[model samples]
Target: MKKLRKMFVLMGTVTLMVNFCSFNILAEDGIKQVSEVQTINPRSGNVYYKYKIINGKKYKRLWSADKNAWVDPYWTLA
Candidate 1:
C-alpha cells in the first residue's frame, strides 16, 4: 500500500540518477584533450603535438614550431 508505493518511487529515483550519471561518464570518456607533445603522423604530414582520441577517432593538437620534426609517417596509420 503506502509503504510499497514509497519503495517503488525511491527505486525509480535511484534508477534515473544512475542512468544520468552513467550517460555523463560515457560522454566524458569519448573525447579528451592532451597538453604534452606526442608524435603524430597523418596523411597531411608528421609532427609532434598534443593529440586527442574521441570515440576512437584521432585528432591532432596544434603547436607552434620553427623547424620540422622528423617522424615516421607510417607509424601513425600503420
Candidate 2:
C-alpha cells in the first residue's frame, strides 16, 4: 500500500510538470505575436500596412484595417 501511494504521487508530479511546460510554450508564442502586432499601422479603408527597415530597405506587409485600428491576423486565430 505504501509503495502504491508513492507511485501515485510521482505520476501526479510528472503530469503537473508536463502541463506547466506546455502552458509556458503556448504563452511564449502568444507574447511573440503581440510584439509583432505592435509594429503594424493601418491606413484608411479596410487596408492596413506595416513597413520594416531591413538591410536599409523598407518592406511593407499587408495588415487589416478595422475602425481606424490596425490588427495583425496572426494573433486573431481562435
Candidate 3:
C-alpha cells in the first residue's frame, strides 16, 4: 500500500510540472507578440500600424514619430 501511494504521488507531481511548463510556453508566445508590436516605427511620411485582439475585440494603434508615442489613447478598435 505504501508503494502504491508513493507511485500515485510521483505521477501527480509529474503531471503538475508538465502543466506548469506548458502554461509558461503559451504565455511566452503572448509576450513575444507584444514585444513585436512595440518595435514598430513609422518611416518617412508613411504611418505604421499594429493591431492586437483582446476579449474578442480588435484594437489598433499607429506609431507617431512627431510625438514619439502611440497615436491612440488606449488602442482604438480596428
Give the top-scoring candidate (lDDT). Answer: 3
Each model's lDDT: 0.67, 0.69, 0.82
Tens-digit lDDT string for candidate 3 (5-69): 99999999999999999999998877643334466665655457878999999989997766677
Which stretches in model 2 have alpha-carbon errors above 4 Å? 32-78
> Sort by lDDT, best first: what order?
3, 2, 1
lDDT of 1 by residue, 6-65 (tens): 999999999999999999999988887869988976655444565667678775644434
Candidate closer to the true structure by lDDT (higher is better), 2 or 3: 3
Clashing pairs in 2: none
Task: Give the distance in Å from residue 67's predicted Cα in candidate 3 to where it truly belongs.
Answer: 32
lDDT of residue 25 for candidate 2: 92
